[model samples]
Target: MATKLLTFVIFLAGVLPAADAAIDIGKVLGEHREFSLFSSLLSSTGVARATNSREAVTVLAPNNTAVVAALRGVPRGADTRALLSDVLSLHVILEYIDADKLELLAEGRSGDGTRVTTLLQANGKAQGRYAGFVHISVGEEEYDRITFTSGAIGSPWNATFEKAIAQLPPSVSVLQVSGFIFPPGVIPPQPRARQTSMPPAPSPAPGPMAHPPRQPLLPAPAPAPPRPTPATPNLTNTPPPSGNVIPIPIPSVDGGMNATLPSAAGHRVASSWGVAGLLFGLVVCLIWSL
Candidate 1:
């Protein structure tokens, strides 16, 4: 009877929420050091306060070796702190993402499709790995050298969840399937801008043919009055004046001088030819004289 009662109690405990159930994420993660880097980042970013009371969040985490590997060559300084803030902001989601959702999401995705704005208004991209079968949208900018990053899947939790989280580094940014844990008002991906082909320009209209100007009607010329037949003068010829000498004055040569100048081109050609012939003759004569 005691054993039966114990089994009933165990069943009840298993079914209850952490307030009603036994284990919460903080309690579970308390034991894992692989997640220490993520924890530190959460604290640094003050994200721990947000997650403190939240439940059922499945974190895709990178282990200590993974964290060290990521941070190996990173300078430990103020800059590193700023980088850490962004890295931590990237990893944690407001809610949980379960396994089934992850697989379905992975199968359907390719490339980084969109940036998911979380409840914290943190922005991250969705990336597809595993030949588009697994989606990873991690945005952890490392100030250090990336040495050993956990793969998409890892061992240890090797049995179930480890392969998924371990394969990836312990980052707050991780791949989760759809519908695991939803923060309210998770905005849908933005629509891509539509490419609109411009409409072609309209053709010009045919123009009307131009008409030639009409010829002006001119007034008929007044009929010329019949010219009076030139009167045939009576043939009484006046006798030539006797001994009248009519002298014709010669045209003055100075006033009537009409001289034509040679064309410039013609003069130039004639001058060049003359010079050339003279030169040739001089040469010939010198030869003959010698």
Candidate 2:
């Protein structure tokens, strides 16, 4: 019985180290000082605790500088915690991917890339077929260069894989990327490129036309008093003249003449008086001769 118990104790001791060999994400990240900020974020958001339950996962951990840059524009508040939680979850892919697997994928696909789902998808926050997925592809010029792209709306962001931070084959792998992988709606869409050209100067609004001053109303000059009609002379009451007298004309108001002239009877009377005078002269001359 003593020999059998010693053999069982040795077997138990042999099994304990293998159990303790599982990767601790927090410890893996904590070993690298450059990832200190990312590690703290993972702790604060409780993502580090949840990582152990997953069978396999690849953490694309951004360096301190990259994390700082990503947080610069994010506003602070209660929503920030939730936002950061979502963002950190997006960084975690639900599969084991290391440099070797990435090279194999790149070679197999000819740079077309492979899509991998993330923790965000597992949380059910991502709904569509491609939502909360990371795109892994090789650089066009350099076949060895691997790139990770986030499927952000309108503006997708890309991060180049710098190096493998830590790797435990077929279980967990933490990769150092050039920048943070921002999920759709995480970063504010760039304020639609500030209308730089200065909005076309608003067309000058047309102004009202100026009117001329009105003159005071005047009673039209009383029609000029009708010119007084000239009075007409009464010819019926005037008596006819007995001698050969000619009346001089007088200018009337209308620039015309009004008068009487000598007639044939006056001429005949003059002729008769001249003949009688001549006969008396002849008779007196004969008496003187006797």
Candidate 3:
């Protein structure tokens, strides 16, 4: 009896751990101290809420200082509100992209300058007279040298891609970048020579381990192989040795699912109990008759 009670307790305990497996991006960003500015912008721009609400997505977030600098560079006459909103939109992608996936994409992205439209498309933010496209520069297929160079929407108006800051594994990824990936036509061509097409923007790195860094852009550590456990025997499925085992029905204990006999060991255990019950009942009848 005590052993049966112990088994049920073990099953209930497993439920709590399964709940932890879910990742909450909104809660994660809210608690992180370093994302104050970035998080604020995400809300103000509506990007944060949208991403958190979705199943999965990748975000390239600029730190507070980087965001400030990028905004500061906006020309005097341009609409600051519109530009800032667009800038914030540039940092996020609608699909989930983990570091390992990004690395693989970097190595083999159909880099034919394929343009990836961002969530910003909903905002009516477009580049040139054409639909906007963020082009991630895949330098080469090499392993260690792989990097994010720039994502360009226009001829020379390109946003620099920087290191990843934090991530929640395959579901949500965040990278710190320099400048806005959405280079709306507002940034006019420099001089008439077309001399500087996509000049590299230096990232204002805060520190190595800034803001307890949520998830560095680097690939997630490979998962450890699952450990093997000893196998147990089940009597329910095992062929009953002639009349060796008896079958009985019991309410399913699996949270309303059809009650199922335990595998090998559990089935054998139940059969033994049934056998003991029969022998005891027979002894009682015999004693009563005598």
Candidate 3 residue lDDT tens string, 1-290: 99999999998898656542444555666665666677876776666665666565667765677566655444443455556566666556666666566665654545443344565654566554434445554544543433432254334434444666667755777766554554545542122333567878899877776466577789989999999997665546666454543344554666453433435555776778789999999999999999
Residue 151, candidate 3: Cα error in Å is: 6.8
Stretches of candidate 3 exceeding 4 Å from the true structure = 1-26, 30-32, 73-79, 109-114, 122-132, 139-153, 188-290
Local error of candidate 2 at 243, Å?
99
lDDT of 2 at 284: 100
Per-model lDDT = 0.43, 0.76, 0.58
Tell me the TM-score of each prediction against the true structure: 0.33, 0.56, 0.46
TM-score of 3: 0.46
Judge candidate 3 against the unseen true structure and give its global Cα lDDT, from 0 to 1.
Answer: 0.58
lDDT (C-alpha) at residue 211 in model 2: 88
- TM-score of candidate 2 against the unseen true structure: 0.56
Q: Alpha carbon lDDT of residue 91, candidate 2? A: 84
Question: Per-residue alpha-carbon lDDT of model 1 for 254-275, expressed as tens digits?
Answer: 7652433225444665677689
- At residue 204, give the lDDT of candidate 2: 90
Model 2, 1-290: lDDT tens digits are: 99999999999998877553665788888789999999998998877877767888999999999887766655566767777777788789899988888777555565477778888878887645566888777766666688777654343546888988888878889999988776665653222334457767888999998888887698567788789899675478664564755554444788687744456554665577679889999999999999
